[model samples]
Target: MTLQSVLQSLLTAFNSLGRSRKLLLIVLVIILLLYSLGPRLFGYGTYKHRYQDPNTACMAQNLIDFQSRIDNLDAFHSGDFADAVASKRMAYVGNGNIAAALGSEKGLYIRLNRALSQPINFWPVVQTRIEGSKKKSTVLDVKSGLAYKMQVLSSSSGCINVGSQLYAHRSRPALLVQDIRIQNPSTLPIVVEMDQIRDSGWEHVEIADASFTINGAETVKYKIYSSTVPLLKSDKVIAIAIASVSIESTTERVEANSIKKFHLLTAVHYTQPMLAEEAPKYLPDCIQQAKGELEKGLGINEKLLRQEHTHVWGKLWYSGFSISHSKASGAINGDRINRTLYYVLSNAQAPLHNVMSTQQDKTNIEKILYFPDNCYSGHSTLKSDTLWIEPEDESQIARVVTTWMITLEKLGCKLMVGAVKLTDPVTSVLYITSDHQHMQELKHAIHVKEINEAPAHEHHVIALHKHGHHFGGLPTIFWVSIALLIVVFHLFLFKLIYNEYCQGQERYSRSRYSL
Candidate 1:
């Protein structure tokens, strides 16, 4: 049809429409025009909101001004997780051989390793109870190697505040210490009942005794004023933990506006008995070493101990890399990076003096190299044409793979292949290394995975399907629904236009006939 004729027919059809339908048509046209040009007309709004808001604009400047104050205060602070008596938020503190996951509610779980052997688990080293106080907050200071918590008991008669610091001694790796301070800020004396009950797992325990010998062996004696709990058996004990509470009284009367102090200590010792004959000698040495550590740790002043701990951590920070960010999201990411470094370093130990310099150590270098593996592994060799797969989230896989790459580079191993495929919540990492022996050892040490000769991308898809995560990036149903909606909208618009044109043609024919 001619353009003029079509325009005339459309205009006539629109004019003949009912008032409501005409109004609807006008609204539809306006909507369509706005949809086409809205971004161009209002694009400046985003810039204005982001740059004009005082809070957002000042974030970077504020971070710069307060950067130094927060440098040594790498802490995870939480105030809301301390409501109930049993409320717990766990934070980890460790020194390579010994690690503890402590809850905000004064619960502790320990893990002990001997000569890089498998770790032994010890739960609830000592149960803690406070009669009349509620937890206020918990702060895990990674830089200082301390976990701090505050509790307050308030009543009409008096107010009492309790602050506690829990830390793994940096100087003495096996020592764990807790300091509690009670402050009474009232005219009346407040009677506080605090108890550190020994765990049920601890058998043949003694509280008041200052020392204990394990397995009837006088040589294997621990000289701590606490109970000794041996794991495995008395004769074949692989690990032992000593726990002590300094406060003799279950209830302490705090004088008006005064303070009372108490402390708890736990020491762990373990030995790797390679042969049956070595158990006796090694067990005694382990106990003696633990005793010496406790004695030395106890001799140091509390303030000095904290200073030494912080100094050690300061050295770590100085030696390691630093991350800085000015934007809010960048700041959050920086915090996460610091925490990740803290976790890895907390469980790492420095090399012994002259250990790395010796020819024997050089020959056993592979045995000395350690990598944290909490995910899957697969077997492959330097000359083998095989793929190693790891099933984990993308971020976790990235971290693990990055750690592996760094360690492997230090060992002079070439990285042949590294690839990652992300399928929403499930992610897979494929790696091909030039060191087959190292890969095989790692496979045996960590969780094992199936070796896939298929292409990396295809294997990832297969793994995801096996895990019931078939949804790729977006759901298939979602895209299908979206397409269906678009089709229906176009069909409706076409039908409306065709009906208007048909009605207009009929009227035109009738008018022509009448003429």
Candidate 2:
């Protein structure tokens, strides 16, 4: 059939339908058209429609992506930048009882405590000197409990790459491990020196050559030993021992276009001498124990030790909480949060059962003082007549107010008076502890009359104004309900039209039969 004839036939069929059916057909067509065009017309698929802000959506997605990965760019620092060198401070690595704040360039700061303590710089624990190389980059792999650094050596004779991985053993809190790999890419051999320097407080420092048989071949190794004097005349003694192994020779050498690996394990032990006089007697045993720990750790495969360490860290990280932001600085904020958590985790150890508390005695509480003009005091009070307002100061005040309320509640104080007047300069004050006679004493001391309570309605209005209504605009639920209602209405209309068409058909049939 021709296109015009087919269109005419369809139009005739549509016209022959009853008014109710025709109306229903038109409504269905309109609904279909609207449904097809809805998303495009209303920007339903846009990020703004879904998330309200594109920046917030981007940040949320970035956080999610970071959580799924084992490593992130935030954990890496390129040594080529000037800031990298300037910002080189120690990053913490530890297993609950013992921790080390290790610097990217140099320094190993150690701490021993059940909880986080200030790390002591035991500089020169293990120093690596690559012949003619500079540091390339540093990576902190929090998931693997490892810190990595790369160094590049370029000379007219050859080019070489050196990498080092450092970690504190999770299971063995006193043990720290470092693995060095030398990659020589040119037709020339390179030599690297490894040094374990003794700190000032340590006494009886010794270095010895040792050998270990690996894969039925004897490997040359060296040990450096040191012990600290009795801690402040106490019976305790801290001894440290380091074991170093070179896969090839006493002097670390990487053959032309080949790789060589080196291993260093440092173990620490503390002697629990019962009497101060016995500290000397315990020193030998402490040194032996530290050496024994190093030996035990060295026997284990490096890969297995790394796997176990990473597993422990994985569990800790999984148990910890995560905070995310929706601002433009969300990634930076997330990185900061992660770093804080990492440092805290590095200083935490598994809690021991039946352990005695070592906390000092609580200080006695004397009097609670309130200083209304404290914010305006100090340099500002002396220098200027005009009042200056800062957002940071306001935030600090809010925090202080919150802390004060918590403190009062903890001290069995009942809030008897709370008032805020937003006139001129704005005044806010709180009076607590009506149950104690201190309130009267305070009133007398301040020479102030009793405060008159504001009307309840006025207070209510003020509260409402301060915390403005949080109406969340139109939500998904509202739109969903509207759609459902529209569907139900269409269904009812279709049923009504069907019933009318059936009745009309019956009447027409009867009239035709009577004729």
Candidate 3:
């Protein structure tokens, strides 16, 4: 407030920057030079829009033609397999065995759209990342950050107060967030906010006129609340919500209805998941069973090592999430960088690489899953690294349970699902976060022998049929009867043809010589 004080503050700031100022200025100049000479840099992309224009129709038609060409299997285009197989890691980890599988690399695609405000300007860029994955039926952790080239999207339309909370950017045009759906997933009670305005340290939103009728039906609210994607009971596509702020919460996941349910078909060829009361017993028995068959050269494929994979519908998110939290200075729009974004971004995260081998050296995890020592912990709220086994294989995967029961029971986790058909060899389980920092806790195992990569299968040797045929050799009665018949026939043939016929031939020859 005083000239001396202002002068002192300026001097202090200058002193702080003393030597570093030269380096900072040099860095700034280099960056300015690069951007001025650099090709366009892409940031986060916007929501995908439906084809509503004539050009869109033409593009759609072109796409259809291209698809038809592919369907015909024209030799000119070898196939999707060519390039993918070239990159042999083509086998998706998600589609492999649970215990032995790992998640895959992820990326975000970007584009820009603005009519007037940002003509010839770069569009918003989206930076996507795989937060993490779990073996649960739902819940995929995802983290995203954003950088803008063009301006952000906002509504010229009027805004409504969310819970009477006045945002720092109340005078500036507030953000207008609309339909935010949890695609292919269920609705969960998440802490939804329009945008965390950093300046005021409060969540804000632009909630207004988001409902519109579809096919003559009543317009629905933007957000759903369900354990699945509908966000509500009986509804299919829940309206999207316009929440600027969201806290860590649980929810159900949904998928495109077009995606069909995949079930493992168990025949003699299917891999079987073995369950036992003790690991020591299971290990020995499995080894013995496999060795016996290998020595005799019977069903040798029964013990080959295999990998694990999943067929999960992954979670979707964008980069603006971090940006909205970061740049929001006092009275600044959510699009600006601020403390909230820094807070959300300061930490780091990793994807799902389930505990395959607990060995000190995480070498190639052949056929086993090495879970955490406290995997079975009963804690309702677990740390980020914790694994949660679902209830389905409670009885069948008894070995996993029994081995880790002390920990699981203590943690208060329960089991679910129907009894084993004595046929299904694969087991399913869910792993969850024990703590909050971007959890991707998933545990999986495909054992040594495997079938499909979706989960560990139940494999049965073809020995039962082979055993019956092998032991059912020759019968005593039948063998004796055949021997007796052969002996009698031999004697009869000797008397009728050998002796009498030869004598007659000799007598006729002598009579002819005498005459």
Candidate 4:
């Protein structure tokens, strides 16, 4: 058929249809048009969103590592003591140069090695005194920082005595003395005494001092002392004295041994101010602040506070970590600063104080996935000023996951973990950054099983691919289906109209003939 004739025939058949069918045809055409142009006309699709801040990812990873290290308590002492030694060495002289006052650095290292293997007492010096004959005192010149002394007294039985004392030194900053060495130049038997003040009188405290003594005419003796002393008070000092306890009477005057030529050698320790300030770099502020809060909350005295601080620090020195980014001129290391900020936030633990309370009915995943309008105020990223959530029970993985997910979701993030058994005590699930810049990172959470057990887990995750409202436009398949339906419906209507019209014309012709 010619184009014009075909068009005319189709139009005539369409006109034969009822009003309802025509309306349906118009509706289908509109639906098809709307579906095709929906994205441009309406502007809708799944919005790209962030479930967590990529910037703080490295800090979180560091915290996880630190927590893992601390969770293993048996290794705590050695790690902490080594850090303490290194920190002290750094503070005293610095990394480049070791102070001559510390005596032989080699000897110091050896003593530190011994400290690692054995229990060592460490204390800060309060005040040091060198005493001679008849209560006469030898002086340590402040400028030179050196001490010299002579024999205090010799008994009728041939025993000589000398004294060196340590009281709290008020002028200097507080410090922890890990080990001390006193060198005796003469070869003779030497006995050292440590007298600690008690309620009644001065009492002898038995100490294991590594003594290097050789019995010869001019035998040289070396004495090593170590103490893990309590935190030194600002004003108080403990007294320590060393004297010669001879096994037998020696009438022979060995000038070097008899003169009592001994040097303080070295005071091995680090200052307290540095210790307190630098603690957060290696230890979590939450744990430390929690200890301080306990002290204040319970009205703990200095003695108790000291005990608690020592106990807590000894156990966990792991803090969050920092990763360095591209060096900006004079920019503080972003990773270090973020780690510090993480600690501060972790200790704050006041999520809903001024913030809106979260709805309880929401599932843990929903709680994480949704964000309120005001939640992102003042920050480009979702603001979770108080992101820390205390795990309800360590034994149950669900509790941990739920708690962490809720916290993360509040910050506009989601987490996925493998199928985890709640009963596995050693299994741990944590979120971490893959790199320093926190990009191209895996969206999945890590499930870590204990080294000793069989691995049991399934990959489970809530994939975060986009942000904003999830629906945008109809798919290509949907559009194709609509087109097919419209074509089929229109064809059905045209056939019906054509058949009905033909039947009517025939009936009319037949009736006229019968008349």
Candidate 5:
């Protein structure tokens, strides 16, 4: 059986085939071709058209731009999470508007007015007595037997607006005195000390006796004191105020810088320092954990970026979900499809549940999923460690589970699934490890192929398209086509073997019987 004989034999058998068998062979070839290229050429199934998840499209673009900026790459910097968080916070607080940064429609002043609980309006008149005739009485010179008097008078009260209500009062305004101190004006090294003063809530604070000696040689005695009263602006004034008092030597007065120090009570939000001892439990547990993590010089500060979330600041398994696209396969549109990514916060789980279960929720979920800038603004709720998905339909749930196993392998993350439960027909619980190694693992997972080591001009877009992706061995279409060809070739070879040997032997037996 040389090559010539084998070729002749195969040709003879093929030529001997009837027209029907040949037609069948032609039909088989046509079917194979249709199976291989039909969907790609004609557009059908998942391969009907090129798919780009609307949710991830914007994120992918921003990620490309951010990765390109070598100078401002803090967000992607390995192990520098705090700097990333700071950058995100600054971006959120655009134009120095705190309310806007906090996602409030109203301004900070409006919030402040709403936040005020106490109501009192009394503008303090400095150097004026509170008693009848509110007259100013200033002391020019003071001697051993002379008494000096300084008073701060309160003006008649009026109505003030706080939030939605107008607080009207006629009583004298209350005063909150911070400090009363004495400082030398002429000395090169300023001398300052706190003076004792008694104060009552409604009555004027008065200091009756005071004496002092400076430099151990210059003995100076002074008698007179009053509880320092805080000056309050009129109801018309929108700005809040603080009052401080300082005493200066009459002999050597420097009007410009008379007070050595001034003290006022800090605002409520800023008062209780973020220290452990004084820290309020009202702070999110994640924020507290973040503070601890920051002190340890480890992990990122998620608190600043997600102040509203309870678990905003921790490197912990906040939440996760698995989604199937079974129902979405037929629902593919320009803005949505079966295959899409969603960036959602842990706090949004309840709302997500409500939306996924109803028709109304489907429309709202689109807004949540397709966020502005694709929610990749560094403030993105997308945690690299935690995976979230949108499911297609109930039938794809098992397939989705299996697909996740492959995805997890590709991601190469050392994740421990904390919980797993079915949320609905499409959603499943999928909590995973949210440790410090997550970002590193994620970066390693995504492949940047065809990198140009030499800096190229306007090369970022091209480089990103070429480099950005996980180079999983081969495209699904190409693999499927190859599999189809193998199957078809096997069937053709089986049919050839049957005709060449089996049928030939049957004819030989019939010839022997006839002879």
Candidate 6:
């Protein structure tokens, strides 16, 4: 009964306007509602530019590694998975009991040795048998005259038990088993000594005290053997890898100091159905030991040493060396199964002038793995989060390129980053020091991989959810705006109907009074 009542009466009169006026009011309410949703619809494009660089290779590795781990409940309970087990490489409890019960061609269990996109069907491979006319038997029969074979350990990163034997879990003294492994496939009764294994790749043709002329000109000749059979000069990579094993324990103490320090790290594959059972406990304990001893990592002997993958670096650059045999092409392609050298960047104190005139141009260099502050020589299931030096501009690159062949000496992995000596590149080898000297390089590269800062994916993009919230008790902004518009339209329609009804009632009262 005051100013408010007078305004209400005026508002009712205005609401009694025509249908066109009512329609305009509804349209106005809809426009206001849409205004609330405007920002989110157009805000996406502004946050999409942080992931465009070559350093993205490291980023890609990080992304794929994470994707490999995301739980797909749909796949597991659906019964569509297969598991592969490498038994020869399983746990070893006794001194000589390291070798397991044997399987067909290779071991009691074949090496999963590479990362498969999905769980592999080992039954088919295990059941697979060679035809009588195939290579193994045929080759043996053909060489019946007076066959000699050799057994080699290509490379390994395992815990070593040095000195004597053991007692309980605490008994085995740990030591670095660089380039070490037991030989089940070795050409039975042959030794591929440690010295020969150290000088296996093309990078060190110059480092070797003695050289084997491919033409076999001299009697003091150097040799290349696979298992026991000496290889012809033209022998292939697969042949070399098959006969190689990386053994650490028995290797000379001097050589042991030359390899890189081992780090305990996490891999994406740790969550697989096969790995899930063991990885949870084994991975952490192993990583913890490695971390505790990072200052002085303790490498011990375990039958499962090879299976658990330990990290180590090359003391010297020897990419293609074999201890027991020649390498095979198949081995090179499948290096990811047992990834070796983890690439890193170094802020080497080395000067810029140290860089060569040729390396001045980034385009001219063969490849740039770690720049001034990058780490991790490269990556894989086995060697993740391992660290190394970043190359200074010129001379360092020259040094690695001029004298290197990418080797899987530890896990038989090859050429993780820069080109090995014989590796084909338009430019000469460009080196960002891929060694373990620089700690900063390793940290930065790891940070990139962990945060998934690379790639133009949803994860990398910034989400404004934290800041895009509503205010004043609003219902998620969008909902509130929609509700407000409906309220506005209903109120306008109600006023129109109420005003008409009120006028009719007043007229009826006036007529009754007149009567």
Candidate with top TM-score is 1
Residue-level lDDT of model 6, residues 63-84, one tens digit each, is 3422322232100010101121
428 in model 1: Cα distance from truth in Å? 13
Model 5: CA > 4 A from native: 1-37, 40-91, 94-99, 102-473
The alpha-carbon deviation from the true structure for residue 182 of candidate 4, after best TM-score superposition, in angstroms, is: 55
Comparison by TM-score, 3 against 4, better one: 4
Ten-residue region with minimum lDDT total, candidate 3: 109-118
lDDT of 4 by residue, 443-491 (tens): 2112223335434432221111121123323465576667777876887
Q: What is the lDDT of candidate 6?
A: 0.26
Root-mean-square deviation of every model: 13.1, 15.7, 37.7, 29.5, 28.9, 24.3
lDDT of each: 0.51, 0.51, 0.24, 0.30, 0.28, 0.26
TM-score of each: 0.51, 0.49, 0.14, 0.18, 0.23, 0.21
Task: For candidate 1, list the clashing residue pairs, or say none.
Answer: 381-436, 382-434, 382-436
Candidate 1 lDDT over residue span 1-515, tens digit each: 99999999999999999755775677567666655655567673234434343322322332343345355547765444444222125455666556554452323333322112233333323333446534455566777777766555554544456667777666566777778788876688777666555444554433334643333453222223233334333343443435343456668788887988765566666554344444455555555666666655666667887787777776677766554442322123345556556655665663331112465755565454553432223222211211122212212322343343333332232332343743222223454667776665443222223434435657446435444354444544457556655765776687678778987899989999994
> Residue 269 error for model 5, in Å?
12
Clashes of each: 3, 2, 77, 23, 13, 73
lDDT of 4: 0.30
Write down the worst ten-residue block by lDDT for model 6. 137-146
Residue-by-residue lDDT tens digits, candidate 2, 192-301 = 77655434444466556566555566453645454443443345544434444433333576678888776777666654324545555566676676667777777788
Better of 4 and 6 by TM-score: 6
Candidate 3 whole-model C-alpha lDDT, 0 to 1: 0.24
Q: Write the per-residue lDDT of candidate 5 for residues 1-515, one digit (tens) a residue.
A: 89999999988987899855775677677767877777768666543345754322422332343354223222221111122232111111110001111111111111111112122122111111112222121110100001112222122221110000000000101111122222223223222222222122423422233333333553323222222122233232122221212233322221322443222111111111133333334333423332232222112122221222212112112343433322222322211211122111111123332211466766687686665433211111222222233322211222232333334443332332332543212121343545655544433333222323434445453433344433433555677667766876777778888888999999999999995
